[model samples]
Target: MTRLVDVVVVGGGQAGLAAGYHLRRRGLDFVVLDAGAEPGGSWRHMWDSLHLFSPAEHSSLPGRLMPAQPGRTYPDAGHVVEYLTDYGKRYALPVQHGTRVDAVHRDGDRLLVETDSGTWRARAVISATGTWSRPFLPAVPGRDVFTGRQLHTVDYRRPADFAGLGSVIVVGGGNSGAQIAADLALEGDVDVRWVTRRPPRFLPDDIDGRALFDVATARRRALDAGRGDTGGVASLGDIVAVSPVRAARDAGLLKASPMAVRVDRHGVVRADGTRAEADAIIWCTGFRPALSHLAPLRLRGTRGRIATEGTRAVDEPRLHLLGYGDWTGPASATLIGVGRPARNAVREIAALWARS
Candidate 1:
C-alpha cells in the first residue's frame, strides 16, 4: 500500500518533532516515522545516570517548555524521556512508533520513504535521524588484537556493570568519556584510566549547554554579517562540569592520560613503552550521522557528509538534513539549539512546496 504526505520526517527525535511543530504551523500534511519502539527516541536508551547538560527549562523543543524537575539543577535521562513523550502528545503530532525507514529515493516529483511498516511518498523529506544510532569507535592500532571487552557510549549503562573488572580504560576526550570515567571512578574500587588524544579541556564551572548555545548563536550571527569567526563553544573548552564530573575532577580521579599508542593482546601500550592491562575498554569517541537510509540519494561528498545550503541538501533541494551538526547549522545538535534550524528548514520546504 502507498501513502502520501506533504512532508515525511525520517526520525521522531527532538529534531524531527521540532520540524513537525513548524510544519503544522505552515499547515503541511506530515507524519513522523520513529525507529524506536516507544515515543522517547534515543533518550530512552541513554545511560541511566545521564543528565542533560542544561537545566530542564533551558532544554525544550519548539512549542512547550519542559516541566522542571523538583530539587535538581539538571534533568536525568528518564526525565528527558518523559518530556519528549509528552511533547509529542501536547502537540498531537502524528508519530508512527516502531516504523524504521529502510530507504529514501526519488519517486518522480516526490521522495519515497520506504519503511518497515509501509511506504510513504512525500513531497519533501527531513532527515533528522541524529547520530545516536551510529556510534563511532576509533581504529587505534592493535585494537583488533586487544583481548579486553570493548564498549561504546551507546552500549554503556551503569558503573556497576564493571564491578569485578581489574581495570577499565576509557577512550575519548569529550563529555561522554569524562562522565563515564567519572561514573566508573565513583565506584571507588574500580581502577579507571582516562585517555585522550590531546590534553583534555574542561569548561569553567559556571558554563553549561545554555551558555554554549548563546555563544554559538553569536558566532553564527557574526559570520552571517561578514564579521569573521568570533569562535563558538570550542573557545570555552570541552567538558562541562556537571556535579559528577566536577566531583570526579576535584578529587583527582578524572585526570586524563595520553591515548595509548597501541593495544596488545593483554591491554594497551603507552607511548613510554609501558603496558597497561585492561579488563574492559569503553570508547566514547562519538558518533557519525545516521544517514545509511539516505544512501540511495548518492548525495554524500568525499567528506562523508551531504553538502548543504543551510538545512537544504545542495544536490537535492527536496531533502533537508537537520541536527547532524555545525555544517547544517551552528549548534543544531543540541536540544536548545535545534529549534532555529528546524523552523528554518520547514519554512524553506513550505516555500518550495508552494511554488511546485
Candidate 2:
C-alpha cells in the first residue's frame, strides 16, 4: 500500500518538528519521519559537556520557548534532547520515529519517500536530515597508517574516555575542537594538542548564538536589498566562547597548533616536517549533509549540496531542504535559527498546494 501525505518531513529533529508545527497550524496533513529511536535527534549523540551557543531562553523553536535550566547559564546537550522530546509530544505532531528513509524520488507528480518501514507518497518532501550522522574527516595523507586510535566528533563522548591515554591530538579549530580540547585539558592529566588549519578565531566574549544569528540575518538582508556588502558571519569570528572554552582560554589551556599535513605510523606530521607523538586523535573536522538517502534523485552537487532558492530546491520544485546550515537559511542549523526556515519551507509548500 502507498501511504500518502500532503507533506513528508524527512528527519524529525528540531527542523522537522518545527516544520510539523507550522504544517499543523496551516491544517496541512504531514508526517515527520525520524531515524532516531526517540525524539531528541542528533542531540542525543553529542558529547556529554556540549552546551548551546546561547541560553535556553534565546535557543528555542518557533512555537515553544525552551525552559531555562535551574542554575545553568546555557543548556547542555541532555537538556536539548528533553526539550525536543517534549516539543514533539506537546504539539501532537505526527512523527514516526525509528523510520529510516532509504530514498526520495519522483513517482509521477508526487514525491515517493521509500523507507525501511514502508513508502510514503508526498506532494512535498522536506529534507531536514542534518549533518550529524555524516561527520567530515578530511583525507589527511597517511591517516590510515597512524597507529593511534582515531575518532571523529560523532564518536567522542566525554573527556574521561581519553583519560590515561599518553598524548591526545584534537584536530580542527571549530567550536567542537576547542570545547573538546578544553574538556580534556580540564582533567589536568591528559596531554592534549589542539590543531587547526588556520589560527583559531574567537568571537568576542559578549557574543553568543544570538549575535552570530543577527550577523547572518543582517548579511542576508543586505544582499536581498542590494545594499553594499555587509560582512557576514565570517566577520563575527569562528568559535563561540562557551563556558568551558572561555575558561580554558583564560587559563591558557586552549592553545592550538598548526594543521598536521599528514599522519605517520607513530603520529601526525606538521607542514614543517615536525612529527607530534599521539596516542589518539580526535577529528572535530565537522560534518557533511546527510543526504545519501536522496542519492537516487541525483540532485547533489560536487560539494554534496543541492541548488536552492531559499529553502526550495531550484531543480526539484517539490523538495525543500531545511536546517542543513547557512546555505538553506540564515543560522538554519541552530535551535532558534531553524524555526524561520521551517516556517518558510512550510509556507512555500502550502503555496504550491494552493496553486495546484
Candidate 3:
C-alpha cells in the first residue's frame, strides 16, 4: 500500500528540516525522509576540527537560534550536529530516519516517492538531499597511473591521517582546501603545497560569514529588482581568515600555486612540465548536487541540475529543490539561508494544493 501525503521532503538535513518547520506551520500533512541513522545530516560527517566561518548567531535556522558556545566565537561541527538534533526534537517534525529515497517519478497529478522502506504518493516533493554525498574530483591526465595516495575532502577526517607523509598537495582554493591545508601544515610534519586554479581571495580580517550573508542578500535584492551593480560586494567564495588559516598565512604556508596538469607515478606534473614530489594528494574540489533520485523525472537541464525559480522546478512545478546552492536560491545551502527558500517552497506547495 502506498501512503499518501500532501508533501514529501526528501532529506532531513537543514533544508529539509526547515521545509518541515514551515509545512507544519501551514498545517500540511508532510513527511521528511532522512537517509542517515541520526538527525544531524552531513554535519555529523565533517572533520573534527572544522568550525563554522560564521558565529552561532549568524548561522541559525528560521525559528530557533543556534545556542552560543561559551568563550567560542565560531561553533564547531559537533555543536551544529547537536543543535540540529535538538531542533528536530523540539519541533517534533515528522522525519523518517534511515529511509533512503531511491527515486521520484510523476504518477498522474501526484509524485511517487520510492524509498527503501516504502513508497509515498505525495502531491509535491521537496528535494533537499544536499551535496555532501556527491563529492567531485577533477580528472587529471595520468591519474590512473599514480601510485601515491589520493582522496577527496569528503574522506578527510583529520590531519593525523597524513602526519608522517614526506610531502602532500592540497588542491582547491575554497575554505575547505585552505582550512585543511592549514590543519595539515600546522599539526603534521608533512610539507604542504596548496594548489588552486586561481589565486584565492581572502575577506578582510574583520569580516565573517555574517558580512558575506548580508552582501549576498543585498545582491539578491538587487538582482530581483532587475538592477546590476552590487557595489563590489565580497562573495562567499572569498576565504574567511579563521585563526588557524591566519596563522598559516602569517607563517607563509598559505601560498598557492596554479593547478597541476597531470598526475605521475611519484607526484603531480605542473602545466609547465615541472613535477612536484608528493606522497598524497587531497582534492578539495567540492561537490555536485545529489539529485539522483529525481533522475527518472528527466527534469535536469544543463549540468545535471534541475532548473529552478526560487526553489520550484521550472519544468516540473510539483518538484522543488532546496539546499543545492545559489542556482536554486541565494545561499540556499547554508544554515542561515535555507529557511527563506523553505518557506517559499512550502507556500507555493500549499497554494497548489489549495487550487486542487
Candidate 3 C-alpha lDDT tens digits along 202-252: 878777778777787788788889999585345444688988999999899
lDDT of 1 by residue, 107-128 (tens): 8999999999889999999999
lDDT, residue 334, model 1:
81
Off by over 4 Å in 1: none
lDDT of 2 by residue, 1-356 (tens): 78988899999998999999999999988899999988898999998988888999899998899999888989999999999999999999999999999999889999999999999999999999999988898989999999889999999998778767889999999889998999999863779999999999998989988888889888888977899777787887889888889899999989989999999998899989988999999999999899988888888788767989899998898999999988899889999899999999989988887898
On TM-score, who's better, 2 or 3? 2
Candidate 3 accuracy as TM-score: 0.97
Measured on C-alpha atoms, candidate 3 has an lDDT of 0.90
- Estimate the TM-score of every prediction: 0.98, 0.98, 0.97
Candidates' C-alpha lDDT:
0.91, 0.91, 0.90
Structure candidate 3, residue pairs in collision = none
Q: How large an RMSD does model 2 have?
A: 1.1
Candidate 2 deviant stretches above 4 angstroms: none
Q: Tally clashes: model 1.
A: 0
